[model samples]
Target: MRTNGDLNNTSAAREVARIDIDAAHSYRSLAISEAEDDATIRKSYRPFLLSPEITSTDWISKLELSTVVKLAEEDLHKTGERLKVLVLYGSLRERSYSRLLAFEASRILFRLGCDVRVFDPTGLPMKDDVQHNQPKVQELRDLGRLERRPCLGLCRATWESHCRLQKPNRLDPPLRRLRRPTQGRTLAIAQVSGGSQSFNAVNSLRLLGRWMRMFVIPNQSSVPMAYTQFTDERLADPVEGGSRMIPSGNRMRIVDCMEEFVKYTILMRPHFALFGDRCSEREERVEKERKATEKARKEAEEKRVE
Candidate 1:
């Protein structure tokens, strides 16, 4: 997670340079243990990084990359704050298409001057499998709670390969336990399908966002025939190409969705309090406090009169 030295490196390298700082620094430096070191090095424990790179075409052309930077900078200039974004993707396949797409969106967000963290759900336990203190579970909760503001959450939720082969939903189990952190967050959904284009996954994600009290954006991306969407040879040989997970044709839509997502998050930043304030919850708390005060005063008056 060396952030400072390698601006000129390939696009893939630049992306990996932005792994979540918290994930990298989770363990203390003064105390070293073999188990801790193993966890840090394992692919699942740390935030995802691109596999080693080889010389290849840039995932994004220099011109396009510059345009994205300029537009994002212009739009976000007034805020004067770096947006904190958390990306969550489903699927644990070695080459999950959802992960690839998440990485692509992360790059755009990073260029937009966002402090982005992608939660790796690989080893995450089921909701009942363990307590909140489980390492992976804690990592995700920490990321979700990174900012109380309505910062952006780019979620790529997916079903099985092509159809209704329902495996345990990777995100829902973990996120159900994360309602506190997710409340008032802004979410953008994307889904990948192995066959034809389908909104099933994204639609389900939208429902989940609603249940979580998140601001789900209107714009979304669904890539059909996803297996063909990414370059194969490039991803397989880490040394032969820049990165295989780079999306080929659906790049424009993905970028557009991310742009809208970022802009909406910026637009909503000023009203975080408005979004977070729950009238019913606040009223209930106030009622309880009032009752307690009344009881206390009655007891004091009775004792004094006696």
Candidate 2:
């Protein structure tokens, strides 16, 4: 959560730096809560100077156990290596609940024989900050390039004049040019702190993924009152649930979503897309040429009639 200053310096005023404003649409900070916050507040920040310890649970619920077994049955084509995944989280608070959830998901994924990597969003300038080839950007790109052709991130979504993911994010299109790393890859979303359990952010991501030609998986997860959903090391059990229950409420949704992602990846492996979006771009060019040719024919026909 320490976006600007050293984690050791807890008292420093090293808050997030000046954000580059997006010119297309003007934003005004309306309701900045000393106690509550929203995405519109471009500079809204919380100080989480400590890293959270992700707890592991060996006790699997019957629901989770059954889901895993069913997934295994569907994964007859186990490609022999752990599936690789990349997780991105939004917010810089040292104890970002979303980060905790992402980490918890990573632990579960790792236990499920996944080769997982979680990106620290620190120094990740907004997509509008610079070109897509910037060091941090390239690192993200490369991660999506290798053996694992999918990129998944934990993101904070917002609702303003309309619905969209958090501003100044990595998925900005102008910076990426033609080589979109997410193109032809698998994607899924998990949101946190949806006071109303809104899936707006994930829905926006789904649209953007399709625009980039990504094979975004249909399943996604969103946690309402996300804080109530986790503890120091793992997801929290329902506050009102019976005794001896697992501390995982909405956490199972994450499992369900990821399980679906794995199965779809295997099922679509052979006919997977080629990255860089060249194929889509090529289609656009062909469409334009067809229109132009039709116009020429129409003009010729008009001349002959005259």
Candidate 3:
């Protein structure tokens, strides 16, 4: 009894309804499968993604997360630790004098029994939008994360003087953030200048250090006529036959300052390591105990067989 127009309308409605139902079912299935895949991936890679290194070969194949957490807790209880110090130089010139000063500082730290690392700012892109994944940038981040040390940034005033005409305050935020030298870490400024112009460089460095909220040592050194002071081997040249050069005496003073810096660093390190509770020595002891227990059990089983 229905007309042709009525029949066509009904047919069109049925077709649209069917399409909607099919689309919903398809989407539901795809979502379920995607969730399952994600769970599988997480299960497969979770351990490696967490620890990243299997430090000990003797760990059980199927350790529960709770057990791992307990061991980690125990490790943190056993040993006192110290903070790491990262040293950075703020010059990119070929044969940079500031870098040389940093090297001399590092040697002093090594003598004082503190862990130290140096960062080269050469090729570090100016802190901007496009320079995220650069190797040097990543390296800086990794050191910032792992070293857990106070930072020291060294820059030469002579270089700053030359660049002032081009960029008045260039090495401010980027180097400051990159260094992240905490208040507990000492930042010693060494300004290498030409002739009597050393005072200008030291004052400028002091202002920058103050803005960064760093613990600046006012006992800064200015190496006047820096180029002629070093030998081909980079050692201080003797100004006279019987006495050391002015540069050599200055280097010795830096070493003395570095010794005090290292003492402060060592004092700060234990507190830094305490928060994380990571102790290598404790882990080693636990491992040793586990091995002894396994050996004893094996020997007892062999005797039972005999």
Q: Largest lDDT belongs to which candidate?
A: 1
* Per-residue lDDT of model 1, residues 9-60, tens digit only: 6655534454233432222111112353345333443343343232222343
Per-residue error at 185 for model 2, in Å? Answer: 1.9
lDDT of 3 by residue, 1-306 (tens): 665567556656644432222332221100112233346433532211112122111121111223222222233244332224566666777676666666555544432323345665656766675766777777666555425433332322223354231122334445456543433344566666544434666676667666654556657666666665544544422322111223466656565555445444334444654433448868988999999999999999999999
Candidate 1 Cα RMSD (Å) = 12.9
RMSD of each: 12.9, 20.0, 29.3
List TM-score per model, in order. Answer: 0.71, 0.57, 0.49
Off by over 4 Å in 2: 1-63, 66-78, 129-133, 146-164, 168-181, 232-249, 273-306
TM-score of 2: 0.57
lDDT (Cα atoms) of all candidates against the true structure: 0.64, 0.52, 0.47
Q: State which candidate, 2 or 3, has the greater lDDT.
A: 2
Ranking by lDDT: 1, 2, 3
* lDDT (Cα, tens digit) per residue for candidate 2, span 157-238: 2221134456435434432452454455666667665366777767776776677666778787777766566444344343
Q: In candidate 3, residue 16 scores what lDDT?
A: 45
User: What local lDDT does model 2 show for residue 49?
Assistant: 14
Give candidate 1 regions above 4 Å deviation.
1-80, 146-152, 157-159, 165-168, 233-241, 244-249, 302-306
> Candidate 1 — what's its lDDT?
0.64
Better by TM-score, candidate 3 or 2: 2
